[model samples]
Target: MSATSVPRARRRSAAPPSVDGWELFAPGIRGEGTAARRAWRSRYVRQSAILDAAAAAIAGFAGYYLWFVVFAAYGPRPPLWAVLVFPVVWVPVMLVARAYEERFLWIGVEEYRRVLNAAVLVLALVATVSWGLRLDVARGLVVVTLPLATLLTVSGRLAHRHWLRRARQRGEHLQTTILVGSRETVAALDEQLQRTPEQGYKVIGCCLPSRERSTGADAFNGLPVLGGVTDVVDVVHRFEVDTVAVLPGPEIHGSVLRRLGWQLEDTDAELLLAPAVTDVVGPRVHIRPVAGLPLLHMERPELTGVRRWTKELVDRSAAAMGLLLLSPVLLAIAVAVCLDSRGPVFFRQERVGRCGETFTMLKFRSMVQGAPKLVEDLTRADEGNGVLFKMRHDPRVTRVGRTLRRYSLDELPQLINVLRGDMSLVGPRPPLAKEVEKYGLDMHRRFLVKPGLTGLWQVSGRSDLSWDDSVRIDVRYVENWSLTFDVMILWKTVGAVLRGSGAY
Candidate 1:
């Protein structure tokens, strides 16, 4: 439908029900309209409240059991009043901390952060009460219970989010979204939403900035043009949208946006300002108010610091321990490799490392002897991207090599590379000389950190990723490298390796 066809909202004299201080009712929408919208407004809110209450009860019980039955730390037994008051205190505190708020519940780390904050607040409250009343308390038990309660609470929340994510994949419980920006921005936003429906946004249509005047295009990038920027309230009423995403563009200025916020102040539709800077995660961006204006401060990544040394230490230590612990498996694999083929057990290749340096990357041989010599003959049969040679049914792969490659046992020897500082446990993939030579200026950012045996590339799709996608993810990793991010990648790598979707 064109923007001009959207029905205008009927202005009402009486007030509508407020949502988080904004009016949520579409005045003209009748029948079961306002009541139905009001009911859904608190759907996730109530869900979160019930889940948090259950988490609090479970954590409280576990904490009490651990303190009294297991540890017996509070002089013969803990106080009954203290045990009973925990869940009572915890749940109310969580509610007060805004942990059950709809905005942060299942979307991002903010939910986890709120849970942690509530845990800390509970601990502080208990400590203050104990000291003030001069009550005999077990410090060790308190320590144990605090962390235990926190862990349980966060885990419960994660489980809920997992369930929600699965439901969202089935196209349920999604926010009907409308984009308010230029055609290009709206189209771009739509593509991202489609790629990750688990984000809970379903873009039904879009409103162009030129809605005040006529835009030549009726539909854009497969989405219906609902109306112009000025027609947002009318469009919201027309479609009964749940979210209004305002992308960065010339048509939506500061004054224009303030007016929109005021207009939306009486509607349940959420106003989201999506900045133009894309692919930037939360850790890299900070907002601060200076002289009554919110200023965005972009933090450049910190690649060198004590944290970097800590990561290196962890890499080397883990590599050494892994080699020792898995020696039996390693020996069995080596024997298997040797028995499967006549050539040496190990294969080494020259790969481009950080800053264009060359290093010998080790792996169990996953191909027949003289495989390099056969590459020229099989060039016509290559099913891989032009830069990297790969084929699902490569003739050069031996029977055992295929099995080893399928499960990534062939890459186990790269632990040595990690120990030697030629690679990291998590980073961008090490590129071959031929591939590195094809890199553009932006692609060169991948070299800022050492390559890895398993990284964004390995976990994301391995050999299935296109050259552009490979470069995009690799550069993103290099620009946003952190210890926590590396650890997350390492954890996710286990599942990716198990699935082995893109492995040849």
Candidate 2:
């Protein structure tokens, strides 16, 4: 062979050619540093600080007042040293409880639980110390302080919560988040955020993971697609993203995911995982380390023994007491319905109850005498779907019926259903026989327990919720059934009824 025809051994390139190519494109790509971006970043920072200070101030004041109570009851207040040290202990406890976390600050049971636990611990320690020191402390002082501190601190947080909620309504101080996922998943998530922007996540852009390059013009609900999955890290940096939600998808690999997590370290942006479990509650998920791998254990929700008895007792007691306490209201409603329409004071409907058992569920009549048969005539005009039949403004509704439905007073007679053991104070809302007939297999799982007078559906968004969302909430409640959760739902139910939120 000629010398010119002989091939020379080639040396490897010092760096990958891809790196050089990327370098050329890097400077031309713009990131999230526009004026709106800077404003959003600053607003979140300011909000965080304000909320933190609010938490600290409330906690501190509570601690001091509690100390004062014990001091006053003992005939002489504690020395300045004890008073100063009291708030010190409270601050750490509050921080540990993450009372400063924004999500728990507004009308959540978490905040109250933390506050109560911390207060009880602090007071218990003080009592022990007083006994050890032989300092005379009166019980009244402790008792008085408990109520005083709890009242003041809770009231303060509530006031702050109101202010923050109003601020959100005016479109001030919200976290700008970038969702990274497949086109379909991100699009669905973007829809939720768009509908409820007041929940406080502003979608800046979508980082869609596609096999092919995504045009920056591609949009989900009008939000731009900044780049494809391969450009996620770059997009994060470019967008100055406060939060990155890795929504449900199979495109991301474990190694690539770990790399993404590593890249997020020390960045101001928060990394959130939106696992594919659509109807799971937080309490049911437990993580345990096994053989160097973190495994999540999901406990089956079973109501038996104490839990069953507790629920039954709660149902009976609450129903009995409610019937007695609301007797006057019931009487008034009965009179109003009688005077406003020809319908009976009470309406009786065949409903599917526990374990697919059919029973008569009683409620104060909220419509004209023969409304059920009218449902057939209105089928084409039905504003609801699947098992629900809702009309925002139904013609069959009497003047009194509208008021009764709006405040949920019509459902008060379900207390009788609870007494008969066909219903619960809290569970899935009872379904009509016709509705139950349409149940798919998964839908029947709701009947494992007795139907409820009020439930996750009632407390969440009631008539306003879509069938899917309602079913998801019910499934979550059933899967994560706990006494604590039941208590919380009942508490929320009160607020829902009072606010007339998601009612007729």
> By lDDT, who's the top model here?
1
List candidate 1 segments past 4 Å from native: 1-43, 72-74, 79-82, 209-215, 376-386
TM-scores of the models, in the given order?
0.86, 0.79
Q: Residue 420 error for model 2, in Å?
A: 1.0
Give per-residue CA lDDT, model 1, range 14-74, as digits (tens). Answer: 3423222222322222333434644653876667667666666666667677777887655
At residue 175, give the lDDT of candidate 2.
63
Span of 10 residues, lowest total lDDT, candidate 2: 2-11
The candidate scoring highest on TM-score is 1
- Candidate 2 local lDDT, residue 388: 77
- What local distance difference test score does each model get? 0.78, 0.70
- What candidate 2 gets wrong by more than 4 Å, as runs, is 1-89, 92-117, 124-140, 146-151, 158-162, 191-198, 212-217, 220-223
